[model samples]
Each structure stands twice: as C-alpha cells, then as structure tokens.
Target: MAKKLGLKQKYQMMTRGLGWDTTYQSMDKVYPFDKFEGIKVHDWDAWEDPFRLTMDSYWKLQAEKERKLYAVIDSFAQNNGHLGISDPRYLNAVKLFIQGVSPLEYMAHRHFAHVARNIRGIGPAVAAQMQSLDELRHAQTQIHTISHYNKFFDGIHEWRHMHDRVWYLSVPKSFFDDAVTAGPFEFLTAISFSFEYLLTNLLFVPFMSGAAYNGDLATVTFGFSAQSDESRHMTLGLEVIKFLLEQDEANVPIIQRWLDKWFWRGYRLLTLVAMMMDYLLPKKIMSWQEAWEMYYEEAGGALFQDLARYGIKEPMSAAVARKEKNRLSSEAWAIFYQYTHAAAFHTWDIDEEHKAWLAEKYPETFDKLYRPRLDFWEKEAAAGRRFYNNALPQLCTVCQIPMGFTEPDDPTTICFRESEYKGEHYHFCSDGCKGIFDNEPEKYVQSWLPVHQIFQGNCGGASVEDVLKWYRMNLGADNLDFSGSPEDKFWSEWHRTASRAEAAE
Candidate 1:
C-alpha cells in the first residue's frame, strides 16, 4: 500500500492547491477588496504560510486543548475554585475580561473569517481560517471558563448585554468596531499586526497571570489553553506585515500609518488593562511600567529594528505610551473608582496597601499627581460620602473614553484636543486620538458615542436607573462600591463559616 501523504503535502493540497483562478469572473471582481486599499500585490504566490497547520491536525490539537481546559474547569468548579481567590476584588478583573476582552475574541473570529474570505492570497486565507477558529474557540472557552464565576458573582451575570450598552465597555467595543469596519488590509494591519503582535503581551499579562497569581484556576487554565494559538496568531501577524511590506514599496507608508494609528488605539484601549494590573489584582505582578518596558520597549524595540529593513519604524505612539505608563494605571483606576456606581463592576476604596503598591510602582508620579485625588476618594468613602460623578462625562470622539487622561508631559491637567469636522466640534483625550480622527475624520465622525446616545434619550431613558436597566445591570447587585456589596458580604460570611468549622474541628 502506498504511504499516506506527509503533513506538509496535505497542508499544500488542502490550502494552496484548492485555490484556482476564476473562470467566469475577473480576479479583480472576485478579489476586489485586495487592491482597493492601494496595496500592490504583484504575486500572491510569494506569500509564505507561517505554519503548516492542516485542518485535520488543527482539529486534533484544538480538541486536546478543549479537553484539558474543560477538565481543569470541572475540577475547579466541583472543588469550588472561586472561593480560593486572593480577594473578591480580583473577580472584578475577571469581570473586565469577560465584558471587554472576551467579546473581542468573537469579533476577531468574525474579522479573521472576513479576511479569510476576502484577501486574495491562499496562504493568508488558510492562516486566517485557522485563526478564526482559534478566536471562536478562545471566545467559547473564555465564556465557559469564566461562566463558573457568574454563578458566584453579581457583575458577571449580564455581560454580553453590558458589553454593548455599558459606558466603559464602549472603549473596547469601539476599538474592535473600527477594525472590523475597515478594508481588508487595514483590518489585518490593525488587528493582526498591531493588536495581536505589537501589544498582546500587555493585554495577556494583567488578566492571565493575574488569574494564576490570584488562584482562579478556571481562568488560568483558559489562558493556558489559548496561549499556543496566541503564539501562532502572533507569528501570522509578523508574516502579514512582511508579506505586505515586501510585496511593494508603495505598501510601506500605508502600513506605517496603520501601525501608528493602531498602536495608539491599542494603547488607549489598554488603559483598562493597566488598571487591572495595578489596582484590581489582589496579588501583585510586575507593575504596568515594568511590563511595558519588557513587552513594548525592549521586545517591541527589537521587533521594529528587524522590521526597519522593510521601512517600518516603531509606532510614534510607543514614545508617548512610554511616557504615559507611570500615570496610565493610576489614571484608569481613578476613572473606575469615580464611575463604579454606573459600571457593571465594583470598585473598592483603595486601602493603604494598594495605595502603597501604587506609590512603589509609580514612585515619581503617584505621590504628587494621583494620590491627592485617591486619598480624597478614600477619605470621602470612609466619611459616608463616596464620590460618584453623577453627571455624564464627555467621551473622546475617537477613543470613546471619558476625557479624563491628563497630558503626558504635564500629568496634573486634563489633555484635551479637538477639531471642527464638517461643522461639528469633536473632542479627543489626546493628540494620538485626534491624529487618528484627522486621518479618517469621516469614518470616526459616525462613531456611536454611548454618552451622546444616552443624552439623545436612545438608551432606554434619561434616568441613571433607567439606563442601567437598559444595560441589564441588576440595580444594587452589579453597580456599586464593593465595601458592602453582596459579594463582599458573601465573602465575609464564607470566611466566618470556615473559621467556625475550624473551631468545631
């Protein structure tokens, strides 16, 4: 009997060999999106497949991961893993992941499938097809993994509804929405190259390692299951850039512009993650600045040096993000602290330990710039007058975050930038956001700013309670300070019961 074909042969047969030139329609008509972005692809044949992952092998590998993931999840749940976390506050980080990041996984699945169908190259099509599946699986596993917490937690119960309607969640929703709505190349450049490769570590750390450090076994396992595929996606991102850059010299500037825009957009989106790392995690990992230096500065610096051959420099935002790192987490936590009353997640008073952590992590800036406001909040909460910014905040027209971030150069004052576009004035949190708007004013102008929608009386009604109901958030359960929350009471009772049991023993 003849031997079965090897993996490489099967991969080629399944991917490259399956594609054919159209007979009835022109290639341009069939692959119209491939060229409209002004990207010249002289030979799609020159594109290299980053991985020789055939569908048969792909299914087997994913099945194994699913088995391992579910097994760990089962063990964790049956053993009551949620009770083992370092603190209930840690669950807020998990809450942020579900509402903000997990949905993006599903969005990524849709966009990867889009590029798979739309991009002309067979190699990328296969890569994107696999990545689409990876994303879908990631979304599924993340939901299943974190759903275990939903039973024990309040804010986690209504997530998908909250993601679409919540004020803070608009940051991630708008970020992904911008990518998916763009042309094929720009989508790939924004998501694949910029988000997945350039800055994924900054994302993975705060949630994944944070989970492990805090003893949420299900989420930790979920992170482990997704890690290998994330590595592959990272490889594909690099390949996407090389193929585009080396295909034509004209592609250089277009690609560079995308890198800069996405880098900034991604950095802004990560403000939430920065807060998670610094404030939400009960157990500390490296500070956001430490992670940024390792991930973005040193590691990304080496990547840009390699890509410099292809005429790509590190994104202009990298320098700005470098300067903002010290202040990023502190500022982000403050936003959550003030707005926690309106958010799906809970924010607690920053105790002295956490305050000290912030001081140690952000020695130069935290004490002078942020602590005064933080101390005020802590003191006010203790005095029975917890501050909630009752008024709706003005969101940046581009990034869609409340315009709270201060100047990177001058950390004390709010950084504001605006432009007159087609007669309407649009505000931005920073020059980075404003530059993105200036580049594509028409695209951003149509942004569905949630705060504006609420003012326009589109989000259920004008009352805070009415809007929260529309967001499907439980009245007192999901939105509030954590000090006297249901979760807080449950946690305290749990420990008290345990202590009684130990005494009886």
Candidate 2:
C-alpha cells in the first residue's frame, strides 16, 4: 500500500532479498531431489513465485486490508445499504456469486491448509502457508461481501452445511477433495497451477465487474482485493510447475499428464462460472465466449507456447479446449436452468435481449441448439407458471457436479462417464473425473455425496419437508424468498422514505 509495486519488484522482495544460502546447509535441502523416481534438481532458485513478498510484508498488508473490508461489510449490513443498490436485479448476480463461489473459497482454504502442512520445501511450504491464510481470508471476505445480500436473499444462510451435503455443493467439494488427496506435486498442479494461474479470472473478474455496474461497491471492492491476492497465488502455481519440471526428468512425464488432466478438469468445472457470466448477471460484463476466447484461447494459448521451450506440451490440446469453449456457455446455461431451483440462485427465461446477446456472442450454435428451449421456457413462463423443478437426477460420485455435461463437442449427447470398482459403479460428470477415479477408485468411492447422505438417513429424514428443514438448520438455508425477509422489509421502507424525501425536496 505504500506505493504501487509491480510483480518484478515483489519477486525481488521475497526470493532475492530474504533468500539466504548457508555454508552449513544440510546434505539434503528442505526440498530434496526425488531419489525414488530419479529426478534431479539443477537449481532450486529457478523455481520462483513471481509475485513475491516476504511473509512479514504479506501478513501486514493483508491484515490491514481485511480489517478495512470487513468493517465495510459490517457497516453495510447494519445500515441496510443493500437497499441502496440500483435495482433488485443486481441481487440476482450476487445470489449467483454466493452459490457458485463462496463455498469454493472455503474449500480452497481447506486444501491450501493441507498443502502448507505436507509440502517438503521450506520456501514453497511457507508460501503455501501464506496462501492458506489468504484463502481463508478470501472465504471470509466473500461471505461478508454477500452477507449484505444474504439479509435480503433466501439461500445465503445455510451455505456451509450445504457445501458438505448438498448435491450441487459437491462440485466444488469434489474438485478440492481430488486435489487434497493427490501427491504434493499433483496438488500443486491441480490447485495452484491450473485453476489459479490459468482460469481464475474467468471465475472472479466478471462477477466483480458486474457488481460494479450494478452499483454494488462492497462486492466490487472485496473482489478486487481478493484478486490482488490471486496474483500471488497464480505465481505460486506457475512456480510449482517450474520447480517440479526442473527437479527431475522423471517428474516431467508425470507432471505433463497431470497438467493435461487437471487443466481440462478445472476448465470443465468452470462451466458454472461461464453460465453465470452469460445468463445470471443482469448487466452483462462480457459474454462467456468473449472471456474464454481472450483469457483461455489467447492468454492460456500464449502461456502454453512459452512452456513448450521446456518440453512441456500444452495440456488439453488446443483443438479439444477450443471445441469445449465453443459449447461451454450455452450448455452450462441449459443445465443451470434445469437445476437452479435446488440452487441458491434463481433462474429466469432468456429475454429477447439476452437471446440477442447470445446470438451475437455464440453465433454458430445458439440459434440451432439452445434457442428453441429458451423459446419454450419463455412460453411456459407466459402461461402463468413459473418453472421450479427440484428433483435431481443421479449425481457423479467424483466431481459432484450434476450429470448434465454432454460429451465433448457433442452438445446433444449427455456426457457421463462410468467406472466399476469391486462390483460397484461409480459415475463421473466428465472424462476428467472418470480418469481421476480410475487412477484411484479406492479414494473416489469414499466421497460423501449429498444425495447418498439423504438415502443413508444422515440428514433429517426421508420426507422432503424434513430434509429441507434439516438443510436450513445445517446448511444456512434461512428465509430464501426475499419479499418475506427483513432485508426486503428494510428495502421497502427505505424506498418509501426516499419517495417522501423527493416530494419534500
């Protein structure tokens, strides 16, 4: 905060200024060469987290920032600032944010905590510890940012319990769970390298921009502050990959496959964010197509080109990634529309403007594949019937996302991968989950699917009402309909006062 420090300057602070070489260095460095696989490290310093600040500097800045932000959230909620938003339509975007992202940050916190514990390198380990705290801060900041909306929204209260036992919640739970169980190198690849470095902007930036457009300063500030931290997290991910590659030749092939597998897996999982960007945000920041083309296709494409000099092939070949990106927005929208009643967010039919946006953004497939369904839904809405179908189909055991993804590049075909282990069947949402399960069926089967929990009577009861009550108490599912909540009451009264003030003026 003293002055604007660019990435290079920060790197110098952490890796150069604080880095010390001792003459009495132990025979084995804190991060030793991999003897079992015959991997050798030419130089550990080659592994560098680009956004480098020492632990003391990191904590001081981060703590001061969090204190300021949390105070804002407290003031906003207490003073009924949610009513000051430009329109109720803005809440729709915030609702989507709470549902899709808030819980994921918590999960990321858990995994980063684990990484801080288990990783061998003192430098990487300490960096991960800093990230572990950063993630928890992110989780808290997200909750606080959205809690103002929570006062007015229906589903914000029960998020924590839902994250563990809700069917949709499993998407994030499974993603992080997969990482937590992997070898140290792989955990780094999955979480730090692939998700943070490559695709996190796809998840966070649009929502922040939308919040800004919709006149939600708290959400925008919180998002930017957290993303400022993400710059560091991304550097850690890139550094982990570089360190692994340089550590051992034997590590290269293994790391390559992980890079391929995880990049696709994380990208596929981010379809929810893609859908949220396109449909849920009332004010469009950018279409999912545009974001993906720029962020994934161009930026990620360039990163792969640079990595190729080190014998690293682009993970998840460009042809397949491009194909997936083309279909991701509309396909994810269809799935979200189908299942949103069970979700914390609400879904509405695509209006003519939304359709026009889609047509412009996704020219090739929108008209042919998804438009008819949108038309049908619009008609259904016009018939005095709001759609609210809450029944869920079977869920994937591994990824925990719904079984809605269609086969790669084939939007018409449902993409569900199945594997049998020891005479039992395990389901996956995509090839990524399937491959992960196959690699370790023993691990995947132990996943705590929410639906399975209900069947096992671990939740409230077999009855739907009983289950809902249990979900409310455990998962923070408080007053879900805004019109009936205290936030709505405050909003109504504030508007009335505003009208009186205008007349008095």
Candidate 3:
C-alpha cells in the first residue's frame, strides 16, 4: 500500500481545495445574504470544525448507527411492545414529542441546509451539511420510532396539522421560526450556541430518562440515538461561538445580544418541556426544579465561567430564569389543566400522592405557592365538576405562549408587558418577550398569532368545537381530563384482564 493519510490531512484535502475564484461575478453577489447581518469574517479559513470529519467517514459512522437503531425498532414492533409500557399516560409524553419536537427537527434541517449552501467557507459548509443530514435523520427516526404508538394512541395521528395549528405548539414553532428567519451568523448563534449547547440537555435528558423509566424501549432507543448526534452539534455550537468571538471584538456585542434574546426564548419554549417532565410522566425520573439546577445552574455556571475570558457574561434575565425554575412547570401545567380541552394532549389533576411528591421536590414554592391551587382543583373534580377556562387566553406576540406566567418578584400577579406599534396594541408575557419585539417590532408584528387567527375567521369557524376540529383533536378521547378518558379506561381494563388471566391460570 502507498502512504496512509492521517485524519487531519484527509479533512483538509476534502475541504480546502473545493472553492474557486469568481471573476465573472462578485463574491457579495454570489452570497448576498451574508453581509447584511453585520458579521465580519476576515479569514474564512480561520473557521475550523472541531469534528474533523470527512464525508466518507461521516457516512460510514452514521450508516452503522442507523442500522443498529432500525434493528431495535423492528424488534420492538413485532412483539407488541406497546403493552409493556409503564402506563398509557406515558404515551402522552410521546405524543408531545411527535407533535411539538419532531417538526422542529425538520425545521432545523431546512435552516441548516440553507446555512450549508449560503456560507462561504468549506469547513463550516461541510459541517452544516452533516448537521443538516443529522437533523433530517433525527426527524425521520423520531417519527418512525413514535409511529408504533400511533397505531393505538389518539392524539398522534394528526401531529403535523397539530404542530401548525395547536396553541401550545405555537411556542416551539415561533421560537424556531425566529431563528430560521434571521441572517446566517445570527441563526448559528441563536440555534447552535443558545439552543443546542446551553439548553438542549435540559430538553432531551428528562424525556429520554422518562421513556426508559416508563418501559417505552423504542422511544428510549431513539432518544439515545438522537442525542449521540447532539454531541457533535454541541461541539459545532461551541466552536462557532469561539470562532466568532476570536475573529473580531466588534462581533462580541452582537453575539451577546443574540445570546440573551435566544436564551430567554429557548427557556420559554422549554416551559412545555418542564410541564411534561413534572406532570405528564407516570413514573417520574427527576423533578423539573432539580433537573434545572443540575443541568442549567451547575453546568451552565461553569460554561459561562469559561466563556468569560472572552468578554462573554451570562445572559440577561438570568436571575428571572433562575427564580422561575422553581415555579414555571407548575404555572404551565395549570394552564394546560384548565385549557386542555382546546389542546391536542391530555391533562388532569394530580392525586394526593403526586402532590406530596411535588411538595417534596419544590419545598420552597410548591406547598406555599402552588399546592393550594391543585387542592382547589382536586376538590372541584371530586364534587363532580371540573374547572375549565373556556374564554380564550391572550398569547404573547413574540413567544406565542399564553400570558399565564407570573411576575418574578411577586408570584401572585401575571407578568404582562405591552408595546404600541403603528397605533395597534401588542402584548407580551414578560419583559423578555417585549424586549425581543421592541428590538425587532417589524418581524414580530407579522406573527400569525393563533388566537388572532381564530378570532378573524382564519382558523376554522369561531367556536371552540370548530377550532378543535381544525386542530384535528378528538375531544374527549384526545383532549381534556384523563381520569375517565379512553386511555385511562384502557389502561385499567388492560391490568384487570391480565390479573384475571393470572388468577385463572
């Protein structure tokens, strides 16, 4: 054999010799969108991907992992694996995944494709290309993994439509849409740094662990597989942030602004995740407050300390986020519990045991601030009347979540902020959302707010049933209280039948 090539040499050979001088057209004309964002890239070659992956090696590794993943999926499907889950209630977490998160993978795929094509450097471009494929794979695998559950579940069949039209889903959709619409550098900063590196573990870990604890083997497999790729994506995020900061001191403030804005946006989007972790899973892994402290406060504290050498401090409103960690999950679940009839997922009052668990998990806030509300709801439920908030709740113009979050200092009052643009009033759920809108009013004013669309006759007809029909919700089956719902009835009957067979044997 001839001389063997080293990994770094092969990466360079594949990435370095790919670009050509353009005498026929100007560089700016070729890449028109790169300059408008005010990013300064003095040397494109200065950008280095830490992964050092060539296309050949990349395909080989990905193919092997996917083959292993599909093998597990097939085995699960042929054996009636759905019956082995901890409870039917656990599938609600899967429904939330397919509805709220799977489509985001596809959106990430689309944006990464744009980044791959538009950016001028070969190293970054190739990295983006790999990430684009990784995201597309994640979307497909998530859907494929969850499709087995759809054979027996209610809310999963219409997830694509639900992602577009559901009220809670608008939170994630709007957050990704904000990132996808920005210029290239800002898009990378928004997604790669803020979302993937800083906040992704908080989103993925609990769901994966919950799946495992609930005996959903297929979901656990897929979650683990998707997270393996997340490591590379996280590396890419850190590299990009450092590369930008190293390139020019002027790039610092712009990145810090994007960091602050996207950090809060990503946190607000995770409010749904917090609720799912705390309230939805039948067998809980860790409390939302504990997970936040472990993942965000402890780990993120170290990350910021490392970045501080480059003049990057923690995000603005870090204090508010820290304070709300104790309270956001309860607040979000309460909103879902009241308005669940208008949603695609199910919700119900936690029993006394679960309430005690909450008290133990959130000693500072649960019994004092949140448990009384749960107590009142449980009483109402016992007396043969369940409380439901029928009137439409106002949505934040930016994040598109309901205005149910309370002020940080005083947890009694809802934190509401407003701005007037062109003599039309706009409302925000917090100062963070208002700040995002004020900085880019033109962008957010054009938001396709779900509530506004429902009122203006754009989403089905004007009635709640009409709106539910538009969302493809199955009413009593898919939405609303889960105590006596189809899923609950099925689970009870499942265990009862198994017991009867055992006794007969």
For TM-score, the strongest prediction is: 1
- Candidate 2 residues lying further than 4 Å off, grouped into runs, are 1-46, 49-52, 67-79, 473-497
lDDT of 2 by residue, 186-305 (tens): 777888998899888787777778788777878987987887788888889888887877776777888787887788778767777787788767678888878988888899989888
Worst 10 residues of 1 by lDDT: 1-10
RMSD of 3: 1.6
- Per-residue CA lDDT of model 3 for 438-484, tens digit only, reads 99999998998998999999889999999899888888888988888
* TM-scores for all predictions: 0.98, 0.84, 0.97
lDDT, residue 384, candidate 3: 89
Better of 1 and 2 by TM-score: 1
Return the TM-score for candidate 1, rounded to 2 decimals.
0.98
- Kindly report which residue pairs in candidate 2 clash with one another: 154-480, 157-476, 158-475, 158-476, 158-477, 406-415
lDDT of 1 by residue, 1-505 (tens): 3479877778788889878888899978998787778988888899888688888899999999899889889998997788889999899998999999999999999989989998878888989999999999999999998888888898888888888889899999999999998899999889888999989998986688998899888888888999999999999999989998999999999999999899999999989988888888889888999999999899899999999998888887677788888888888887888888899899987778888988888889988887888889888888999999888888999899988888878888899899998899999998899999999999998989999999899999989999989999888889889989999999999888777977999
